[model samples]
Target: MTTTILAIFALVYLGMILGGLPFLQLDRTGVALLGAIALISLDAVSLQDAVAAVHLPTVILLFSFMVVSAQMRLGGFYSWATRGMANLPVSPPWLLGLLILMSGALSAVFSNDIVCLAVAPILAEACIRRQLNPVPFLLGLACAANIGSAATLIGNPQNILIGQTLQLSFAGYLQQAMLPVLLGLAACWAIICWQSRGNWQSSAPLPATPQLRSSDEQALDRWQSLKGLAVAAALLGLFLFSPLPHEQLALTGAGLLLMSRKLHSARMLGLVDWEVLVLFAGLFVVNHALQGTGLPATAVAWLAAQGVQLSEPWTLFGATFVLSNIISNVPAVMLLLPVASHELAGSMLALVSTMAGNLLIVGSIANILVVDAAARHGIQIDWRRHARVGIPVTLATLLICAAIFALRL
Candidate 1:
């Protein structure tokens, strides 16, 4: 049983690293789900144990926020915000600053992937209309969204997992993460502006209007947008001051939005990333099965004997940075959560894992969404273009976060 579970774990993570198994037609989520099924079929984990392995609170919180993001999207809030930012009567550099600020702030509260997905094409159009380079702005959007999602527990899926699993206070985590997130956003803007020097103007001719799906070009719905904003704002207040479980509060907010007369629940729920939730459930069961083998504890003991501790913040930081790049942030967090022990481990994992996503285009879903959206509009941003901004922004943000964490020592 132990050997079987170990093999499944290894293969699933390999799929994660390679984006899929060869000739398998399976992505990371599919691989993980299959692994869990294999374990259950083998009786390595019973159905009840498999169900118990999943952290329902984390899953619920993630689902609830996805619903909230869907509401905002349906209401045209994201596109509206992007248009509002693009239409600002500011210089190119100033506009870049505003873009970073807006993306970061919005991502800190909502789903960064959804935020980027909704904004990317509209932003491409805006840049083309303004005769400015869209690459840097698109890069900024990805980087800022990645950084900003580290600000709060519910900002991203991984953060939600870490916060709930570690029992970290929502307000407490925010206090620790806010400074570094702010610094990182500023760094993103600076690196983008500096690298894009004297090249803000668009050199290539653009179409009179961007080619977009009708849904992508949503007009602002004032009342619906206001309603979503109100729910989001109220949730933030509750998260800060109330003792209510975040999952429940967010679900309440989602339910309230679903009860709206115009927008249907199916529309909002359809936008939820069910695959991501399945990925989490699958990993939870697989990891729990591995724990039954007692290998993780033994490995920790072996590492400690060799003076290679993983529970320490610095070690965890390095591991998170490497693993996050290798297998993506959410899976990396799940793999490392077992070894995390420091009081600040959750914060370290959440921030480092997220900020590391900017290192490469495949490092985060947000980056992928932006790149795909750009491709749809004939705005190509291959890995090389992304790295030009991503590499520097990642380095600066990680360094700033490390420095701040050091001060806490």
Candidate 2:
């Protein structure tokens, strides 16, 4: 049974690393789900135990926020915000600064992926209209979203997982992360500005920008937007002052939004990223089963003996940086959560893992969304272009995070 569980676990993570097994229809979410089903089918874990292995708080928190982000998306808040940013009467560098600030701040509150999805195409069109190069601005969007999501525990999925699993304080984590995230965002603006020094004006003749469908573009619904903002603001207050479980409060907020007469529950629920929720569920079970097998503990012991310890913030940062890029942030956090013992471990994991997503094009969903979005308007941001900004920005932000963590220590 141990050997069988181990093989299943290995295969599942292999899928994570390669982004799915060759010639298989399964993606990461599918691979994770299948692994859990296999564990149950083979009696490696009982139905009850498999269910227990799942973390309800993390799952619920993620689902609830997805609904909130859906509400914002349907309200057309993102398009309104991004369009407003692009049309700002400012120079190109100032415009880059504003984009980073807006995207980062919005991402810190809502879903980073949703922010990218709604803003990317519209941003491309605006840039093309101005005859300004969109590549730097797009890169700014991806990098800022990743950095900003690290600002608060509720900002991103992995952060939510770490916060719930470690029982970290939302306000405390925010206090510690605020300075680093701010510095990271500044670094993002600087790098993009420096890199695009002479290229702010695209030399390529503006291609006719493709028109987005009416269904694709959402006009701002004032009432719905105000409603979503009220819920989000209220939740933030509750998260800070109330000692209640974050999932419970967020769930309540989601409920209130769903009861609105203007938006159908079906529409609100439809925007939820169910696949990611399933991915979290599947990983929870798989990781719990693996922990039961004692291999992870043994490996931690072995690494400790070799002068490498994950309990140390720096070591944990290094491990997270590599694993996040190799697989993905959520799964990587699941794997490393076992060795995370320091009080600052949760903060370290959340900040490092999130920032590392800016390193590669495949690192974050936000990056992929932005790149795909640019392609629609004849703006090709290939691996080389992404790497040029991604590598430097990632390194700079990680350095800022390390410095901050050191001061905290």
Cα lDDT of all candidates, in order?
0.91, 0.92
TM-scores of the models, in the order given? 0.98, 0.98
Give per-residue CA lDDT, model 1, range 277-384, as digits (tens). Answer: 999999999999988899989999999999989998899999999999999999899889988889889999999999999999999999999999988888888999
Q: Write the per-residue lDDT of candidate 2 for residues 179-286, one digit (tens) a residue.
A: 999999999999999999999998878778779755456999989999999999999999988999999999999999999888999988988989999999999989
Off by over 4 Å in 1: none
What's the TM for model 2? 0.98
Error of 2 at 314 (Å): 1.5
Each model's total of backbone clashes? 0, 0
